[model samples]
Target: MKLFVYDHCPFCVRARIPFGLKDIPLDLGFQLNDDEETPIRMIGAKMLPILQDDGKYMGESLDIVHYLDALDGLPVFGGAPDPALVEWLEKWNDVINDLVIPRTPDPVYPEFATPEAIAYFTRKKTATFGDFDGLKARTPELIASLELGLEALVPLLPDAEGASINDILLFPVLRSLSVMDGIRYPAAVDAYRHRMAERSGVPLVSALRASC
Candidate 1:
């Protein structure tokens, strides 16, 4: 029940869904940053969204989500998911790597993008895509691709009120779009994002919070 995660990681966001919907309090407090990597290293993967349950550790986000979903006794894919969605999740990382991450701001803002986190992202991303500036310059194409990608997913999202694995999966992508400028998903996808947020029990997180 002890979950290690960075608030902004899309993977972590996906992993948080079961807890959010079931309203299970995390056994661990807000342990962030390097603190997360320590125990995860013991598991030999050194990854985020690592769940420590009864001395066992799981690394991958999907694995963590699936494990939690099973514990909650929810069907992981019973809602007649879109065929496009199935393909999309299979290629989700590729989409993030090739299109979204490059266009995203270095710090990602208001979602725990500390200096160290930003540094790590830059280093890793640069290694994957080469020349961060060049990647950023392709914002137009990348953003368009992102929109199309999500549009392809809008139909597959579950109608369950705020609590399906699909809702968890889609939330982070919508969040990433909110961070980018000059990017707008078509009306259907935009509406779908809002409804999915409502149903998943995790509302969209905004960068600027009002004092009130």
Candidate 2:
């Protein structure tokens, strides 16, 4: 199976996670940000982490995760999503979006490799997210707000027994925030991030964040 993705996408990370957890062999393909036709050709839309398995194509992040979960041994992400975690995401995702949207394109990712690709991404994102410059200007305030959200999150961290739908949803949000510096992760949150990264074999952007 091959997973086509944009490197900076959290949804892409979601689809990537199950493969690593299950030790499944996957052919990963990186799509340039400006390439609309490829995804359109595959899934009839310009969305990704598209999974191509045995000449068949699939779209949607959670759908791909669920499909891969059954491909090998036992399922990795099972059971219902935790309501507390789900509720927390609903409350905090807007804040997370505010912080993450502007920062993703700045990274040296294959998806944003070209000027046109970067421009395409910027236009598409800023259309929904307002403006990157404004978002960047408000980083300090955004970080402060996110810190409070993180505190609320610490108590909601699930027990480290098995992967849950909550972890699957929760980890990517945290991982997306990992792209920026100065947001202090609570010890438990930091530990959970590292564990999830290790488990999924999808690294956080902290090292990249440090350099930035």
Candidate 3:
């Protein structure tokens, strides 16, 4: 099976969680580039974390997460996830995503991004946000909201003995947020991130950070 992903994307991380838990040997389907036309022409959408199983195509990170869970017979919210918790997570994801795209300045792109991806990102983000400096200016208030979002999410975090969707879902988002200078998470949330990173069947996040 092949999973197309850009490691920086939290949604892509979501897809990886279930694949890791299922012990599936996944091949990289694509990386960030205009160089790859196959995903757009074939999958019909430009999105990270597209899963191609045999000749089948799957997109949407949460759906893919659910698909992986179903494939492995592991229920994320136990036998049936609490509907309210699901709604809450979706809301929190929106909160984290707001800050992630806007405030992540370009100075650090070379640390993990390819030149092509960085160029594409700079153009795309400039168009989307319109005023990068203003966005950067608002980051502190945004970060405060982000922390509150995590605080709300803490109750929904799983007590599962292994890699749970709860932790996997938030890991990359928090990781991305942490990249911004002067960002400091509350001690409790940082502790949670550590515990999630240590889960069984989960890949070492250091691999992604190994000078990507």
Best by TM-score: 2
Query: Which whole-number lDDT from 0 to 100 does residue 18 have in model 3?
Result: 69
Whole-model lDDT per candidate: 0.62, 0.86, 0.62
Clashes of each: 3, 0, 0
- Candidate 1 clashes between residue pairs 3 or more apart in a chain or in different chains: 161-199, 162-199, 162-200
Query: 36-74, model 1: which lDDT tens digit per residue?
Result: 457456577556777888888887887877777777576
Query: What is the C-alpha local distance difference test score of candidate 2?
Result: 0.86
Report the poorest 10 consecutive residues by lDDT, candidate 2.
Answer: 203-212
List runs of model 2 lying over 4 Å from the truth: 208-212
The superposed Cα distance between candidate 3 and the true structure at residue 180, in angstroms, equals 2.4
Provide the lDDT at 23 for model 3: 66
Error of 1 at 210 (Å): 6.1
Prediction RMSDs, each to the true structure: 3.8, 1.8, 3.9
- Model 3 clash pairs are none
Q: What does the lDDT come to for candidate 3?
A: 0.62
RMSD of 3: 3.9
Per-residue error at 195 for model 3, in Å?
3.0
**Candidate 3 residue lDDT tens string, 77-131:** 2355556666876776655555666644343433235666666765777787655
Task: State every prediction's TM-score relative to the real structure.
Answer: 0.73, 0.94, 0.72
